[model samples]
Target chain A: MFLLQLRNELRKLFGKKRTYLGFGMFLLAQSAFILVLKYGRGPNQSMMRMMQGNGYAAAHFFSNLTVATTTLLATAYVLLPLYVSLVGGDLVAKEAEDGTLRMILSRPISRLRILLIKWLAGVVFSLILILAFAVFGACFSRLFFPEGGLFVSIPWDGVFGVFEGVEGWQRYAAAHLVLTLKACTIMSLAFMFSCFDIKPAAATIVAISLVFISKIMQDTPYFHDMQGWFFTYHMNVWVYFFAAPIPWWKVGESLSILAGFNLTFFLIGSTAFQIRDFKS
Target chain B: MISLRNVRKNFGGQRAVEDLDLQVPAGEIFGLLGHNGAGKSTAIGMMLGQVWPTAGEIRICGHDIISQRQAALRKVGAIFETPVFYDYLSGWRNLEILSHYSAPTSRHRIGEVVEWVGLTGREHSRVRTYSHGMRTRLALAQALLPQPELLILDEPGDGLDPEGIHEMRLTILRLHREMGLTILLSSHLLNEVQQLCTRIAVMKKGRKVFDGPLSAINKSQSWIRLRVNDFPSAVELLRRERLITDEREGSLIAVAPGSGTEHVVRCLVAQGISVYEIAPQEQTLEDSYLDLMKFDGPAPSGKQQLQPSVLATEH
Candidate 1:
């Protein structure tokens, strides 16, 4: 029964023109940016200089682009969250705006189940967007720079880290798997806000604002003691995928905290929605 | 069967529906009538479980709405104030998606219902392209899709033309007569309900003011019809003795106060007029409603104040 409802939600989610808007934006950005990175001359020298130790000496084929490290990270940090939040923020709030929420709730289905189906659909969409990012960013960047060892750098600590002699395919696949977790977590937060009485655009704006605020607080030296508590800190856990040996413990801890965040938000949204009067 | 016990709803500090206890039996077309701000919509909302009742118990087909929400809702179908749909999708797809929650429904049933509501030709059009009346029809189609035993419709005639209103009346009548579908329709359109419903309840400022079989309010014993041997003598004798106050259409419509049917017959017969037949015709529902609206005295307690004798003398 729930599967049927989820299928319906997915249909409504994809039917709107706005759903394709984000994907189109990503395709354009990835193609245009990768074009300059590959063909542009003097600019490439400054970028390649960031390569530590040998300094682009043993670079594979042309230079620094690896699906796991460079292109994927560029898309993941900004574009993915904006797009995921759009659909996630729309899941329930759109029904309310359309005045169809009353009709849907009047059915025999439980309120929690109805929302769960929508949330799951949003999670599926979020995962699809990230996976597509990995594929498109990897394949598109490959046209410019040859497949090479992944280039990874920690924030502020510009000390470079490289994964050499490792199969790029295996590393690329692992990085996407971790990225899916991050996408699902951010999308779920947006979905929780969508359950409120506000409009979908407002919900999307609020979700994105929370992400930006967390990112800022995590970067600030004043919030060092509470750094681990911010979701923005954990959502970047995919970066660990490019380390010399995958830090399984850090990945596991980060994923657990995100799972906890998803559960808490889902609970709060469901309770608030069930108690609200649709007529009001 | 639908029952509401001590139902009350308060918005912030103001009350919307106050201590409303309504019970409508199965297979009856019940009209819930009220003017603007009469809490008609609010009462319907509580029945549909869209608004939480501040204090009460509502049961549909023996299932409590609060504790057994799914069970209670299974037998119920409804349309709130206005019809709303996904404007992006065709009307057909909207129904297809909504029917998923009410599982085991068929594509054949969907097609049949759309046709039933007269949307057969335009079912494939996007809802945004539809006019208000078409959207209302689509809402009706959605409500009928569940094949519910209890249908609660709020202002179902708001967007209809005169002909459409006539068709809607027939459709509701057919649903009740043919399918045995019990309906509770809330509206301010007096004539619509007066022509269609078997029973009705009126609301005033968040409180239920009157409820009873329509006949109780519309029927009048004072307006008697009679076919006599001599028309002139009967009229003259009744007028001379002052037995009737008003006469119309070859009948005494309003009998004089302190006079009964027996007195009129005796007066006419004593003057050599033979009375053949006598029958009472009713005033329209409009007349009864107007009278109720103007009354500034005590209110009734549910059905207790609905005694036939008390209502019969209001005129």
Candidate 2:
């Protein structure tokens, strides 16, 4: 039944013309980011001069591009929520809007099964979108800056370090994986919101608003007491992977908190969807 | 079999369905007759478990709709209003998705239902391009794909043309005759219900005023049509005798319930009125329905009041 539902979800995602809108936007954004990183001149040159003055080699271009690409991708967090909303928002609401809920619920399968399938399918789509971003970012960064070195900047610590030696690839891969996981957590939250709302647009707006508001609130001194509970405070947990010795304690706490949020929201969503009347 | 006992539904503060009690026997087509706001759709929605009833019980095949929803729903199939489907997917694929939700249905069964609905040649076509009639057929195909015990169809023939209506009627008859599927069809069209359903329940303002076998309901009312040569004198004589309540169409007089056709003919002849034809009209389901509605209260606007026996026999 799970395989059957997954197949159906895949068909709906690819079969409908509306599904392409999200993918198209992702491609366009990635292309624009790549173009700016490749041809545009900015603080990269100024930082390179400072690095050169500090006796760093020019071969550290790849490390600089990695930093640029990471920052650019991070700044483009808008796409993450949009991608999650596109798929997640339509999980159950679309079925009701289309008048297919009656046909689906009339079947022998339990409501729990349907919710599980839709949630999993939404997760799968979210994962695919994140992977697409990672692949595009990696290719574009490599094209502009092919030389290998490690130029790490600690934004919160107000310090910069350059490691021009072997084992740079390991560090880059580790950092990329951690960043992907962080984005996955955001996608999962958006999906849970999708299951709760009836309108796709409304669900999308709510998901984006939650992330945007939390981020803004976490930066405020007035919200100092509430910052620990905000998902936004842990949004930068990916930075721990880039630390010299890798702060396992902070990373573990962030992962645990994210996992807890994901599980709690998923449970609430499934329970509500299972029992709620789906008349639209 | 499907049964609803004291089922009531409220939207905000307004009552959509009130104390609705219905029992549809297995292998029988029960018609739900009502005006636009007569709570037919609300009752059907609750039966399908799409909306929870504010009060009372709905049981399908002996399973409670609220407590044992999956089990009750497993035996039911329904089509509400327009036949909405995934326009991008082919007709065959749409059925496949619905089939996955139910029990594991085979590809051969899908092909069979497609053939059953006369969409064999066009099964591969995208549903978006299909006409309204074709979509209705596809919807019926999907509903029947699960081979459910009970079928709930709301205005199934609403958008069909003459030939489409004929074809739909034949298809519905085939389902009941061959497949032995119990059907509960709701429609405001009296003639359609008379032709299809053996029993019917009529709703007026969220209340069922009449519920019984179609034949019995039709038989409950008496109609007398008299054709007299002296139309004015016959009308005057019947009015003076208080034998008839209304007269219309110049030559035809509609007599009251207690006045027999023979007695009216005798009185007309005694009054020197030449009686051409005097016969008791066979009270049709439509006539009985109109009479019932008139006694209950004024029917809501735009209600289709079908003609009596003539229309039923002619068709």
Candidate 3:
């Protein structure tokens, strides 16, 4: 029964047009980046200068993997969070606003089970969005650039690394796999707000606003020492995958914190959902 | 099949239901009648475990609603006020999704219910394309999917046309008589309640004003309708002789309980009033509902021995 309900939840989530907004937006952003890199200007000047200074041919590193990784970096912070929050914020609040929650709540199932199923559905959606970003970026970039080596640079996180052949592909895949943590954490935050008595749009906006505030605080030099306390700092730990001699301890710590955030958000959402009247 | 013991619900400063005690026995079609804001929906919401009662206990089929909510709700099926569904999904899909919330329902069973509600052909269409009557039918179909012992329908015929209302009434009657499904039907349509429910409870301002069989309301209060040549003279004479307490238009006269219609006719004849037509007028559910709402305080219940001539007309 649980599996059947989860399947139904997935079907319901994917059945709506809004569910594909993230996929569509990511596709457009990735395609535009690929076009600019392939036809307009070859990779960024600073990235080229850094590679040349490191004694590697800058042109040799201008491959599909590089384009895909760079495009993901540019959009993951803004577009990915926006779309994840959009879906997560809608999972419960939209049903309540549409008055379907009253009918569903009238059934024999427990409220806790209903919320768990919905949260699971939101998690699955987050995974799918991240998967699509990886696949689309890789596929679209391959159409415009040749496959060769990979170069990654995120000066903010102080990560600059170069790899070749299988190692480059493995790291690229691992980076996206780790990115799922950020997607799920942001989604869980919006999902927690979705359980409250608020509109879907308001829930999404509030979740995004909090993320923006956290990012701003983490990025500010004055608060650099305090970055470890911000959720955005942990969320950006996915970028650590590109660092040479990757900081395994920092990665583990951030993963633990992200998992805790997910659990805490779900518990709070379940509590709010259980006590709500669902008058609609 | 259902029971409420001193149940009450308050929405902040306002009370939706105040100390409501009700019992619906097995195999009985019970109507919950109330005007807008009388807490019929709130009471039903509590019964279905959607709204938490501020105080007291509610049980369904011998299970406590708060503690054994899943068990209690398992035996019940409900169509709450304004049936809502996923407008993007087809009616068939909607039923399939909603049915999974309770027990698993077979496709054949869903098809049977769809046909039962007269929505067979339209089940393939999205709910956004459905008419109000079609949506109501779909709601009924979903409620019937789990083969529940108790069915709770709140204003099921609310926005239906007269024909649709009549059809809904027929469906309710069939479910009660053939399937032996105990039903709690909340509606403002007194005529529908009169035709369908065996017993009813009327709410006025968050308090249950009346709860009894349909015949009891008629039996508690009755009037004598008369068409006389001298309407004014007959009313004056009846009032002068203390035979009638309330006089209404069309010469309807309210006599005290135990005052038979024949006796009233004899008294009118004795007063030199020619009564062309005289007949006993059994009070309808609507009349009783209006009377109950008119009172500022708690109205009389079935246990009360009411004198219609005095109490019915009193504001």
Candidate 4:
């Protein structure tokens, strides 16, 4: 049954026109970013040049790529949530709105099982989106830089750091993995909002609103006391992976919090969906 | 078999269904007849365990709908007002998704049901491309994929062409006769229900006003038409003799409830009226339904008075 559901989810993700829209947006954004980095001599190139003067070298070039890619993917902090929202938001609400819930619910399976399948499908879609970003980001970044190590320039602290002498492939792989996990957390949050709303637009709005609101609140002085608990505060936790010696404590805490958020919201979504009247 | 005992449902303070009790026997076709907002959908929802009843018990195949929902739902298949499918998926793929919920249904069964609903050649076509009738057939195909014991169809014939309606009727009859699947169908189309259902329940304002065999309900009222050369004199003669109470329908006079053709013919001829035609009017399910619901208050005591001949057919 689970396999059947997985197959159905995969089919829906691949077959729907909207799925291609998401991929198209990702391609467009990645290409534009690559163009700016290679030909436009944008802020990223200026930063790279400044880091090079501060004792940065080829051994740490991947580290610079990671920072640049992470900054570029932040744009997805807005775009990807909308995509996730469109898919997940329709998980249950679309069925109800379209009057398909009645036929789906009439099957022998329990409502919990149906909801679990939908939630899992949403997660799978989210995973695919993250993977797309990681793969595209890597191709674009490598095209422009063509270097072996990342040069990190911290403007605020007046310090220059480099992951010198590290294997470029390993650094890029680790950076992509960390960014993918961070995007997973955001996608999961958007999915939770989707479960609560019947309208795809409404779900997307709410999910994006939460992310943007949390970002603003984390930076606000009044919200200083609650910064550590906000999911947005840890959105940059992937940066810790690039830090020398790696801040395992902050990394583990952020991962744990994100995991907890995912589980909590997934559970809430399944429960509400299981009990909700399928009638629109 | 499905049974509802004193089922009541409310949305906020407004009652959607109230004190509704009905039992649909195994392998029989039971029609639920009502107007818009008559709580037919709500009742179906509660029976399917999609919506909780504010109060009452719904049992499907002897399993409680609330406490043992999965077991109850296991024996049921439903098609709500419209055909709902993943528009992006092929018709075959939609059925494949539903097949997961039931006992491991085989590909052969899926193919069989697809053919049964007459979608064999179009099974691979995306559902978004299907016509309304085709979608309806696909929805019915999905419902039958599980081979459930009970089928609850709400307005299954709505939007269907005459040919589609005929095909649906045949399909439903086959399910009952060959598969022995009990069916609870709700529709506003009176003639279809009249032709299909063995038993029916009628609702008005969220309350059940009539329930029992179709014959008994139809037998409660009768109409007779008397055509006379001197229409006014014949009408006055019939009224004076108290043989038939009537109202005008064009030049023809329609007699009231108990007036039989034989009685009207005898009375009119004895009164020296020139009777052109004395025919027994066919009492339709619609007329019977209107008569049943005509009363503003509680139904008058004792089985509604009908002519002896009508009573004879009723029993």
Best by lDDT: 3
What digit string (tens of lDDT, one per residue) describes model 4 on residues B1-315? 989999999987999898888989897899998888988998998888888899998999999988888788887888877677888899998888777777667899999999888898999999999999899888888888877889999999988889988888888898889898999999988988998998888887778877878887776554556678787777787778676554445344445445556777788788787778766567788976765554333322224433323322333
Ranking by DockQ: 3, 4, 2, 1
Error of 1 at B70 (Å): 1.4
- Which stretch of 10 consecutive residues in model 1 chain A shows the poorest summed lDDT? A61-70
lDDT of 3 by residue, B1-315 (tens): 999999999989899999999999999999999898988989999998998999999999999999999999887889876878998889999999999999778889999999988998899998999988889889988888988899999888877889989988998999988889999999988899998888888898889888888777767666778898898888787777677777676668787545666776788798777889987776777777776676655545676634565454565
List of chain B TM-scores, one per candidate: 0.77, 0.84, 0.88, 0.84
DockQ of 2: 0.54
lDDT against the true structure, each candidate: 0.78, 0.73, 0.87, 0.73
Q: Rank by TM-score, descending?
A: 3, 4, 2, 1
How high is each candidate's TM-score? 0.84, 0.85, 0.94, 0.87
By summed lDDT, the worst window of 10 consecutive residues in model 3 chain B runs over B305-314
Error of 1 at A109 (Å): 0.7
CAPRI accuracy category, model 2: medium
Segments of candidate 3 deviating more than 4 angstroms: A42-46, B226-243, B257-279, B303-305, B309-314
Clashing pairs in 4: A59-A149, A60-A149, A60-A150, A61-A149, A61-A150, A62-A149, A62-A150, A63-A150, A64-A150
Off by over 4 Å in 1: A52-54, A58-69, A157-160, A164-166, B219-315
Among residues 3 or more apart in sequence or in different chains, the pairs in candidate 1 whose N, CA or C atoms overlap within 3 Å are: none
| Candidate 1 local lDDT, B192-243, one digit each (tens) | 8988888888887788777778776665334677789876668777868887
**What is the C-alpha lDDT profile of model 2 across A1-280, one tens digit per residue?**
6798788877876797776676677767766665665566774565567557767765554454455445434544577556665566666777767777766766666767877777777666666665565566667566666756766666653335455445555655555566555555665665666666357666667777888898889878898788778986676666655567777888889878877877777787777676566553
Which one wins on TM-score?
3
> What is the two-chain DockQ of model 3?
0.75
